[model samples]
Target: MTSSAENSGQPVFTIIVLGASGDLAKKKTFPALFGLFLHGHISPKTRIIGYARTKMDRPDFLKRISQHIKNTTAPKVKTMLDQFLDQSTYVSGAYDQDSGFLALEQEIQRVEREAKIYDRLFYMALPPSVFIPVANGLKRNCYTTKGINRLIVEKPFGMDLESSRTLSKALGALYREDEIYRIDHYLGKEMVKNIMILRFSNQIFGSCWNKDHISNVQITFREKIGTEGRGGYFDEFGIMRDVMQNHLLQILTLIGMEAPRSSNAEDIRDAKVNVLRAIPEVIESEVLLGQYGKSEDGTMPSYLDDDTVPKGSKTATFAAAAFHINNPRWEGVPFVLKCGKALDQQKVEIRIQFKDMGNAIFHKDVAARNELVIRVQPQEAVYLKMTQKLPGLGMDTVMSELDLSYASRFTNLTVPDAYENLILDAIVGEQSNFVRTDELDEAWRIFTPVLHKIDRGLVPVEIYPYGSRGPKHLPEFVTRFGFERHAQNYSWPETSQTSVAQAVAALSADSKL
Candidate 1:
């Protein structure tokens, strides 16, 4: 951890949230700050200022920001929230103008004079339209010369390769790469963070994490709800830009990258960039796109039914694409990425299926292939599906899981939200969990061609029911990329008895042993 005083020689820290009146600020940004404050990660000398064009009083602003914070009946939580809000004040300002920023600078200077605050961190929760102007405004009028000035920007960096480069170039001119944090909240996820540790630290996984042993890798993200009237924004990006190109691709890099020389941020990011460079741009033939229609029942509306959506919009609500890296370690091994909104279930997981034991002691029909599954959300977990001998007289095999479900195992610990983790990383100058310039460039390169094809309506969009899993061809799409579905039925045991124990009991009852 980089100490504020040691790195910046500053005794106090101030965080200024741009677009403070927006939904992102109210729901995620403020809640995350409150989490840091509640956990005592924030310093007593630290101050917070909210900046936006909406002219509202401090009390109303406070009320709006705190409304989404997780409720607790405990008095201590309430007290801490009050203290956090007390340190936080609102400053209404236009995003594109120097006058508003100049006023913001004066307010910051006033707080600094009173509290001796020097280090400043700006969080941009505004739209991409205002990003450049706001960035320029900050640099021109609100920047601090005496201490560290860090800027955290959110994603949809740009529409495609060219636009992303343009945005990157503009931001690079304003702030040095080291001073900017490109926030990809997915990188801060608990299970995603565990990928390197699980592979590098464990010899069992490290030895087999290659093309020789691993057959296929699947990374999937599914959302159960539709646009729900937010189709205007959803139509512009579609599922590929919104999820696969950034979040799912980041997860894939972590899974496919070589072990870094050290835990340094540059080393880790360099390894990730190498992995990204090895991946060829997505081919149109290898991609499947789908837009959601109404549910099977008439109760639900289709994507086209949304009032905000354009008539006959060809935007894809779901996508499944196969990616392969042209490197020695991962050569020919398929990395399948799938993401969709208005699916049957909400899940984010990485599943690595190992090679089958060909002509081994057990028949292939009885013994299933080994698989390492990492569930990133809903209930964080790392479990490996393995085959074991049935606890009975018969020479049969059963499949079960070696599980590490976070909720069941770590009862007392609360996993910090993704935003909380990334924000703290920014405060301490940690860059490994944040995206880099070249990294962003490579990511955009991999998907830009496909994105353009979709944008130009060159690719056909398949229609799937809103509540269905995805397009009807999804099974064949994954199978084409070497993913194999387990033939035998299996489910992780959620009962009191372990899987083996339950199997044993069932056998004993059947045989009267």
Candidate 2:
């Protein structure tokens, strides 16, 4: 594969994965760590210790991750592949007791004894409820006295604001804040990582990146796939808590916050936490919740009708909510975040609409605002569209976009999947790729009122067809806030009216027959 000693300061130790046989580990966590090994990006003696409740041999564990690796291969991954794989070992450790944890501890000790390394990283791939017990057991029985015993845990930190605090208190008792790395893979996305660089490194951008220059921010993380066989989980958490609460809020904080005092983890993380804490208290009028109904052909199952979900489930499959940062820089600018399952297409994008330029006498109809769109998935790119004079006799101006797409612009540039990046961060001892407890609490704070509103029936559950773009009046809701589909007062001629009229006229003709 790659060169093992290429990295200058990798942690000199063994690493462990709790629930190593789980879906996240089998599909994502292992593949990501293996990517680091294949690239020669880790210390030569690093041993990955996989501990799970399931009884499996080392070969079985190794067999589980082969398909995921080939599916996400880097161009330089072919040469040193075996060397990377040689570092991985598997063991069936504790699920809910101390004896199993002792074996896991001994395994880590044996790995260090065999390979002669010290640093230990304990990663939990189990559900959130098991996180506290696993961390406590690891701290009490598993951690070696030699080096760092860092913990990495996955998301949905809590159901709401109150639970988030409770979970944080629980975690704080076992591990120091710095020792706990609450991973949000979205924080590892290439474009999301680039957002800070795009804002601070560019001179022109830094000057106008404020409330005075921007109007509103619209974020959408849409998925075309329905629950499939996951209706049980989808119905319980809903789209709001699943996506908008943590992932979307993190993005908004990145785009809206001021330059951190410095680029260090503490400075950047502090800025994010501060901004998230400032999200104005939510109200009922500013939120919209919805669920997908049965499809027209009656072929697709509705959310409740899915065999896995309980009947008459009230959890929202779709959600649109408004949040405002009380800070002066983003006072009046509405931060609209919406996400859903089984409606529209799979798209994750951030649209920043700049304020319209005031009267420039030379052109009365040329007040079209500029927009900066950051594409986060399927394609990673940054686009800024500005209005300029066209090369024509009429002195007309046309809007043109400046684009920077990762696939097209970067040769030899392979942005690793978020999971891969996060896993690498842990190996390299970088906590910037993770979320802190304060950030988690602030994330829940922004949406807790909205969650309460949905719970108390203050916000109605709007329903729409299974395979459509969310609620029918969704566009109207945004329009009421002095915002529109494109931008304020920038009208485009209609293209859908002819089709609607033709359908109506044809229906009339059919009825007459």
Q: Using lDDT, give the best candidate's number.
A: 1
lDDT of 1: 0.91
Q: State, as a TM-score between 0 and 1, how close model 1 is to the true structure.
A: 0.95
Model 1, which residues run further than 4 Å from truth? 1-4, 7-11, 494-513
Residue pairs in clash, model 2: 1-79, 1-80, 1-81, 3-40
Q: What tens-digit string does per-residue lDDT give for candidate 2 at 1-513?
A: 222223235556577888888888888888888777766666677788888888988788878856577733454564445665677878886667889888887878787778767777788898877877887788889876656667888987889989889889988998889788888889999888999999999998898888898888888898888788888876667888788887888899898888889888889988888898788767778888888888767877678778888887778888887888889888888888889887867779898888767766645346467888888976677888677778978877776677776665563578888987887787666777688887887777777877887876678888888889888988987766545444333322222435546766899999999
- Note the Cα lDDT for every prediction shown: 0.91, 0.79
Full-model lDDT, candidate 2: 0.79
Q: Number of clashing residue pairs in every model?
A: 0, 4
- Lowest lDDT 10-residue stretch of candidate 1: 1-10
lDDT of 1 by residue, 1-513 (tens): 343556444335789999999999999999999998888786767889999999999999999999999874579889988888888888887888888999899889988887866789999998888999999999999888887899999998998999999999999999999999999999999999999999899999999999999999999999999999999998888999999999999999999999999999999999999999999999999999999999999778999999999999999999999999999999999999999989998999999999989878778877788999999987888899999888999878889899998866775689889999999999888999999999999999999998899899998899999889999999999998888887888876543326546666788899985
